[model samples]
Target: MFSGAQISLYPMTDDFVGVILGALGALDPYRDKLRIETDDISTLLVGPPEVLFPAMRDLFVAAAASGKHCVLSAAISRGCPGEPDDPICRSDAVGGPVGPLSLRKDAAIAAVREADVTGQPVAVQFSLYVMGTGDHMDEIYGCIDFLKQSGVFDRSKHFCSRLRGDAGAVFSTLNEAFCRFGPGAGHVTLDVTVSANSPTAI
Candidate 1:
């Protein structure tokens, strides 16, 4: 029942260093709850999905609040056979008896609807991978159906689906997709890229 994310932030501005450094403060509240390590490439956050997504949301929102175009790319995963399990990474969000796909979708949608609003608008595109399962495609398709019904759903892209809305809902939607689609205790990962205040957005 381990979970975590490797995330990187890219700010388009002359003061990228300043923006990045300042935005890091947003993770202060989550410091005690997560094992976070930053290196030259990305920051690795090891924690429950409940804390992981919000931590990422706050960090990205803080950076975007600078009024600069910002992109946050993340590789989120759970139940990886290669990674040793840590008690800090345990969470109720995932790992349990599997339920019907339709029921999971409904619950996921409800969770998104109840998500807190952050006011900062963002767009996200991501692909979900439900590994170590024979019915992986079925799970992915089920997740796609859930996304389309999600209020933030924008469109379906070539290799991924897009979501646009307030940061809260967008991240909540991502959390649900990561938690609900695949086998509760199986290996699942998300490849996500989020953007805010993009100058070239149309």
Candidate 2:
């Protein structure tokens, strides 16, 4: 059995591609499977677990160098085709004025309001599907609760199971949330998507 991970990063603008792709090139040596594709501002990648995580770390650092924000996702597999999975987390939740610590429910809602052209009572919806040995529901909630305290959201617009806020805050928050559910250095695979419309699932 083997498990791998994938990363799809949405740049703030199209011009950021050069920086993202360049980072991936520098990070390729860390993974056996590495590929980069773009659609508008999104960058996609697929590779083994070990290489994937480190590569993502590098990509995050690369992204931080030029952009104001970034979102990342990781997964692990117990069976299938890949390496072992690791559930241990080492990323900081709150690092700066905009990091995890800075993310609050009210602040989250405000960011959406600022970004939305409609400016109508804005709301964001999403569903999380996770697979692993232990039940990570509590850990998931922990992330959401943390978001609420950060003053970045307005109490989760629709469903408040996971988290709700600006697209960027939600994505980055989810990136940290999902990391909690990864397998313990085993083999795992993860996919996270963010869109204007979403189904109600938790």
Candidate 3:
């Protein structure tokens, strides 16, 4: 599907050029996996969640590592609107691509398990929707349980059970949830919205 993120980075400092450059540079290594476009306002990254979320995690980590107050605003979406017949948006039942259903869930889980967010005040908020399933809420809760035990979740920040926490952990949790429920037997689609920022300068 057309999973991607439109991102804007703001650094709270006078000489912000280097911080911006460094943050962008962190994404350079993932160039092969993502389609990145930057302008005066924001950077658009189009790719699968497996690659996109981690890349975002690295980008935000790089920005936060600069020891400046940084805020990353992003809009994450999936599916190709107005192109319902497109293979990316259509399900396998209609002879569409099914790679997303079989995405490596273990890899995403491992990524989140390995991330360290100690002492980082990064905050992230995201909502995940698993569509076209009779047991959608069950699947959604299953994913939520996974995120809760991951240790990066800020339980107090939750509103309606949405997740918020360290950028890396949040991205990793998102990746896991997306892959696990994205293209499964009962799931035909998945939608996610995410916003991440560091409220306190490190």
**TM-score, model 1 to reference:** 0.99
Candidate 3, superposed: residue stretches over 4 Å from native:
81-111, 114-121, 131-136, 156-168, 182-202
Residues 10-125 of candidate 2: C-alpha lDDT, one tens digit per residue: 44556656655655654656544554455653454444333444455555555545543444443322233333422332223222222242344444344334332221111333
Model 2 earns a TM-score of 0.38
Better of 1 and 2 by lDDT: 1
Specify the poorest-scoring 10-residue window by lDDT in model 3. Answer: 86-95
Q: What does the lDDT read for residue 73 in candidate 3?
A: 70
What shift in Å separates residue 128 of candidate 2 from its native position after superposition?
Answer: 5.7
By the TM-score metric, which is better: model 2 or model 3?
A: 3
Candidate 3 residues 48-155, lDDT tens each?
A: 666677787788778888887777777665653532222323322222333432233344466678865634445555556756547667655666666666666656
Query: lDDT of each structure?
Result: 0.95, 0.41, 0.61
Alpha carbon lDDT at 88, candidate 2: 31
True-structure lDDT of candidate 3: 0.61
lDDT digits (tens) for residues 1-202 of candidate 1: 8899999999999999999999999999999999999899999999999999999999999999999999999999999999998999878889998999999999999999999999999999999998887899999999999999999999999989999999999999999999999999999999999999987885
Model 1 steric clash pairs = none
Best by lDDT: 1
